[model samples]
Each structure stands twice: as C-alpha cells, then as structure tokens.
Target: MLASLLAGLGLGFSLIVAIGAQNLFVLRQGIRREHVLAVVAVCTLSDLALIALGVSGIGLVLHGVPWLAIVVRVAGALFLIGYGLLAARRALRPAGETLAVTGPATDAASSASSGTLTATRRRAVVGTALALTWLNPHVYLDTVFLLGSVASSQGDGRWWFALGAGVASVVWFAALGYGARLLAPVLATPRAWRVLDAVIAVVMVTLGVVLAVGG
Candidate 1:
C-alpha cells in the first residue's frame, strides 16, 4: 500500500510539473492575482475527480470510444488556436496600465472602486479556468488513461494510489498558484509581459497545430 501510494504521488507530480497550457494559465492568473484561489480550486478539484475516475477504470470505457477522442481533440485544437491568437494580440498591443503589478492594498482599493467590473472579471477568469482545464485532451489522456492504467496494475492498492495522486494535485496547484506571485516584480514591465505573452502564444499555437494533425 505504501509503495503504491508513493508511486502514485511520484507519478502525479511528474505528470503535472511539466510546462503545459493549464500550468501556464494558472501561472498567469497567479501573477495577475486575478481569481487565483478560484483557479487553484478548479484545477485541484478537477484533477482529483479525474484521478478518481481513472482509478475506477473509466479509462477503459473512454478508450473504447475512438470518436469521442477525435471530437475532443478537434475542439481542443480550435480552442487552443483561438486562445493563442488572443495572446499574440496582447503581445503585439499590450495595455501597460492594465498589466501593471499592484500591491495588495492597491488591488483592494481598485476592486472596491470597481465592484461591478471586478465581479465581471471574476466570472471571466473562472470561465477561462474551466475552459482551459476541460478543453485540453491531454488532461484526459494523462490523468484518465495513463494514470488509470497504472492504478489498475496496483490491484488492491489502487485506491491508496489514487489518494496519493489526489494529494499531489492539491499540493502542486496550491503551491503553483500561490507561489507565482513571487515573480510579479520581475514581470512588472510591459516589455516583460509582451515577451511572456509571445511565448505563451507560440506554445499554445504549436500545441494546437500538433493536436490538429493528430499528434
């Protein structure tokens, strides 16, 4: 049981620690300090639920449905390409004031001053978080198919393994979402933001193209 748990935890961290669309989005949200908690919660919860499904052998069912994978892949590709274009636009025409880093006090004041706008922004952020998580076929492939297959090999220890994976998801997202603010100072300038967005654009578009091509 202990070995299975450790194996799951290690695998979970290894899978999630990579630089991917979901991680990049979470990092951006963390730096902006925009609905960070909500983003973290959404990611962590989604991961846990997926891991559970994987452990319960749902991956086998999904594997049997080839058309479902194709549909998801196409939809994910389109969404990623669209998002990438938006990021490219931001890189080309950055709104310096909007991207400027602010202290907690200033953010509080601004939120209070523009309550309605803040609420709207919160909803948008949450929606983006959901879209990013759900629209990525890789999430299902890695968490559901791969992890589920491995968990099934654990036999009686599968549940323990799933629990460890769930814990890893919670810890990783919490650390990533909260820790990214430390880089806020470094990205305070518009030039830095432009560079970051350009990188994001390239990565997103490339991934989309690869997915579209059935890679």
Candidate 2:
C-alpha cells in the first residue's frame, strides 16, 4: 500500500510538473494576485474529480468512444488558438495600467472600492479557470487515462494510490498558485510582461497546432 501510494504521488508530480497551459495560467494569476485562490481551487478540485473518475475506470469508457475524443480535441484546439491570439495582442499592445504592479495596500483598496468591477473580474477569472481546465484534452489524457491505467495495475492498493495522487494535485497547485508571487518583482516592468505574454502566445499556439494535427 505504501509503495503504491508513493508510486502514485511520484507519477502525479511527474505528469503535472510539465509546462502546460493550465500551469501557465495559474502562474500568471498568481503573479497578478488576481483571483489566485479561486483559480487554485478550481484546478485542484477539477484534478481530484478527474482522478476519482479515472480510478473508477471511466478512462476505459472514454477510450471506447473515439468520436468524443475527436470532438474534444478540435474544441480544445480552437479555444487554445483563440486564447493564444489574445495573448499575442496583449504582448503587441499592452495597456499601461493593466500591467502595472501596484502595492498590496493600493491593490486591496482599489479592489475594495470597485465592487462591481471586482465582481466582474472574479467572474471572468473563474470562467477562464474552468475553461482552461475543462477544455484541455491533455488534462484528460494525463490525469484520467494515464493515471487510471497505472492505478488499475495496483490491484487492491488502487484506492490508496488514487488518494496519493489527489494529495499530489493539491500540493502542486497550491505551491504553484501561491509560490508564483515570489516572482512578482521580476515581472513589474511593461517589457517583462510583454516578453512573458509573447512566450505564452507562442506556447499556446504551438500546442493548439499540434493538437489540431492529431499530435
């Protein structure tokens, strides 16, 4: 049981530690200090649920439906490409205040003062978090199919393995979403933001193209 748990934990980290769209979005939100908690919660919860489904053998069911995979892939590709274009636009034409790194107090005060704006921003952030998590087929492939297959190999220890994987998801997302603020100072400048956005645009578009081509 212990060995299975450890195996699951290790495999979970290995799969999630890659530089992906979901991780990138979480990092950006963390640096911005905008709806970070919500984003982290969404991601963690989504991962846990998917892991559960995978452990219960839903992955096998999904695999049997080839058309479903195709639909998800196409939708994910389109969404990624659209988001990538938006990132490119931001990189090319950044708004001054949007990228400004204000003090904590000022940011809190501003958010507190603008109730409607804050609410709207929160909604947008949550929506994006949901879209990014759910629309990405890689999430299903890695968390569901791969993890599920490995867990099934554990036999009686499969549930323990799933628990470890769930814990790993929580740990990783919490670290990523909260730990990213340490880099806030580095991303203070407009030039830095432009560079970051440019990188994001390239990664997103490339992933989209690869997915579209059935890679």
Q: Please provide TM-scores, in order, for all candidate models, with all chains considered together.
A: 0.63, 0.63
Candidate 2: segments with Cα more than 4 A from true spot: 58-110, 183-215
Listed per candidate, the RMSD to the true structure in angstroms reads: 9.2, 9.1
Backbone Cα, N, C clashes tallied per candidate: 0, 0
Ten consecutive residues with minimal summed lDDT in candidate 2? 96-105
The local distance difference test score of model 2 is 0.74
lDDT of 1 by residue, 95-158 (tens): 6633333444356777888989888988988888888888999788778865675565566787
All candidates' lDDT scores? 0.73, 0.74
Q: What TM value does model 2 have?
A: 0.63
- Give residue 108's error in model 2 in angstroms: 6.1
lDDT of candidate 1 at residue 19, scale 0 to 100? 49
TM-score of 1: 0.63
Question: Per-residue lDDT tens digits of candidate 2, residues 9-55?
Answer: 86676556544577778877887777889999999999999999987
lDDT of 1 at 26: 79
